[model samples]
Target: MSLTAAADPMLPEPFGILRKRRELSDTFTLELEPLGGHRKFAFRPGQFNMLYVFGVGEIPISISGDPDDDGPLVHTIRAVGTVSDALRTMEPGGAVGVRGPFGSAWPVESAEGRDVVLVTGGVGLAPMRPVIYHVLTNRQRYGKVVILYGARTPEDVLFRKQLEQWRSRFDLFVDVSVDRATGRWRGRVGVVTKLIERAGFDPHDAVAFVCGPEVMMRFSVQALNERGVADERIYLSMERNMKCAVGFCGHCQFGGQFVCKDGPVFRFDAIRDIFSVWEV
Candidate 1:
């Protein structure tokens, strides 16, 4: 009944590729600056863009660069599908069609003055990157900032250098864990949930933002609950089969809502009931 797509939100504009770096064996981080006479892409913390590769098709990739940048719009994508693989093979000076900085975002401003807890699993850290930068840049506004990250293996970790830099800051606390570890791995080996036991924060004054596999979020919420965080203060980013970035296609529908428009970011209390429903 309700439509969220704009009259021509389907149109994709050309963006010039500025840089591309291989992040993992199958993943890449692309830096794109809008080329159609526009200098910047206005975006918030959790928004995403519909990246189109000429004839291959399009996919929704979350914005991974700082929202403060004007020229380069960065997106880190995994080469797991046809469209994405094509995008990955593109070189600098290549072209990509971009549609949006759509969907809701993490409540970064509301987090001001409160102790913030950021929990991420695997590539989930990409979407949470902007929020982390915001907190660090405005370090004086918030209280304690804690980051707990988990990956499939030590080699699977994203933003390794940035994580270390953040860890070096005396005011920020970062803990990383891997599900599988090799002989050379010296970090904690387990799920992200394990880090919660050692997490330092006032459960009553803390707000947490979690993103990852839905199963990971499920378990994270349980752990946060045991730590005394209320459902309303816990947030999550949901993934659905988004076809039309504007929500015309029903591929991204969850329950009675469209993840494209309603959210990719939502409070845990708003979607907890539907989270366990496979059909949602």
Candidate 2:
């Protein structure tokens, strides 16, 4: 199907501000309900929404709650710029516009019955959070679930409660590391690539999804390939300067693909060549 044909009907609605606003560290999680109706925003894991803040601006943020949370839609956003800073100031029960459950979702269905490894860094974890939730909630449908996460330091880690819960689950495996130690912190301290060396997996039977800074994705891909994972079995989420979520804007184009339309998620082999071209 054509990309524009995939537009979601739930996109253009004025969602109600259900919980006003709450802080999750330096980021804000806005809980919203349908403004004038009872219909819920339906979406798959890994899909993002274009959240509009009136005069401020709109930004693409991943749907951070469970896909089946029919109650309200949740968006976790960090205050990084003017628009985001404005969003941070929105009171609970205020108004905000949303346009999507846009772009492609992760290949969760294809991952059934296979060993799935999820590797993430920093805020990159936001996009992949739903995928992890999908896998954990439907644990019997997959094989071993391993999550390797890294961040700048302990203070920068997102979803600490969720991460701790994953670590405690006997059915799943969670490993975390940081680039530098902060004296009081006691855990794996090194580059995210360092933890990969000890990530036990039979690459031949595994499907890996990685997201983070471009440099980190490159190194993660190299590590996965070295361990014998097929390029097609490794996936990466791309982050670009996107304007229109629709394909008309060329802001997020990479080679022949539009990151907004074709993917924020792509198979390793599909973008392997362009990834190294410096500029695409």
Candidate 3:
């Protein structure tokens, strides 16, 4: 086996960028393949990896590629900080270091036979893409599949082409809205939570996955609760400030849980008490 396969989980394996696509002005999607031909980075939907950019720094980014695809690992990132900015400017052949596929995943398998509702905003859609891919692949195993996405404006919409393709499918329901309309945009204008009421899924029989800014998630949870989805059936991705992919670093600690190890993806009921608390 390759050293990467046998190495410590904390050791970042070398990888080379295979392709990079500009999704928005500040956001880019990178496709990475292991160097020295290590095994493909296998991970379930919603897991994140710590990406190290040589002398720059490291950041946790969600794996956006389909788990079933025999393709390179993918991460959709926005240039919000130094390390990510360096990654944004990198070319296809640029090198990077990856240390995980870590954290708990969305409970896609457990949600089988129930309606699946995905609510995400801005760049947050990246982590939810894999779940969409899984649902589409095993379409018959689930009931209604609803996707509700919101962006700041039309230009801020990530994965427009992919969203259009998903919308084209008769088996799924995709609705996108913007906080404001620019140019000739004629889509719905509102926060993502507003779309929850009109979504096709039966709230009581649904499993909802939410991600985005914490504020958005808070409101989304409120809306889901009002719509009758149980807290146990609602999940959230708290992808924030994780300096280390392993539990050794306490940067991602929230309440009694460490997001890097115990979560990043958590059931709402499990953290409901602290979920609404400010600056935990």
Candidate 4:
């Protein structure tokens, strides 16, 4: 509950949209700078913030910017509801409020010296983007880096340019797949889990991070397990109903754990008991 930097967790600090880029038809990325001469916002990778759009409402969004970068705070948001829609349409120079950086973080430092495999789908990649940046910036810290991504279609891919750039890097392994193909599309056509079988990594010594729909995550976990990755070495980012990022509200409760406070990122084995429970 006391994980945020705000003096009062309930109050939000002012921030202005420095720039906005549309990633997809319904999703957009916002680059926000502190307003009123405030200090730069810092947050660990995988942590999220409560974004407040005045006269509308607030919603929790994961931090997508690089943790080591001293620049605007970035959030890739999908316009699913009223608040998020407002945020997506707001132009540059528009004002918004920020309240968090709540929840757990990916074990980037611990993965050093071991292979790192990232499995994500659709917008889920936003939460994992920070981790990718961290690994690439400190390339020598880890043994191998592999990224497996999936989308509904070729056009649904997020960060297309960045993914291409990462794919070109000799030190990193990037593979993309889609459920269906479209015009001029020529790449793997299947779920992301298929790539795990051919991916070159020491499954016994590698750590996997997965973020996506619950069904996709469940399947990805199974695939990783079949590949010999231990349950303890696998992590999942859980995005549930998150109101009141400080945990005052019980919206994000998953069994006995509060995802807003205890997680958002949790080791697979830690929640294995309830991960498959219906409506959990």
Which sequence of candidate numbers ranks them by lDDT, best first? 4, 3, 1, 2
In model 3, the Cα lDDT at residue 199 comes to: 88
The global C-alpha lDDT for each of the candidates, from Candidate 1 onward, is: 0.91, 0.84, 0.93, 0.93
Q: What's the number of clashes in each of the models?
A: 0, 1, 0, 0
The global Cα lDDT (0 to 1) of model 2 is 0.84
Off by over 4 Å in 3: 1-7
- The digit string of per-residue lDDT tens for model 1 on 50-111 reads 99999899999999988876768899998889999999899999999999989999999999
Which residue ranges in model 1 land beyond 4 Å of their true spot? Answer: 1-7
Against the true structure, candidate 1 has what lDDT?
0.91
Which stretches of model 4 miss by more than 4 angstroms?
1-7
- Per-residue error for 214 in candidate 1, Å, reads 0.7
Q: Give the better candidate number (1 or 2) by lDDT.
A: 1
Shift of residue 209 alpha carbon in model 3, Å: 0.4
In candidate 3, position 52 carries an lDDT of 97
Better of 2 and 4 by lDDT: 4
Instruction: Point out the worst 10-residue segment of candidate 4 by lDDT.
Output: 1-10
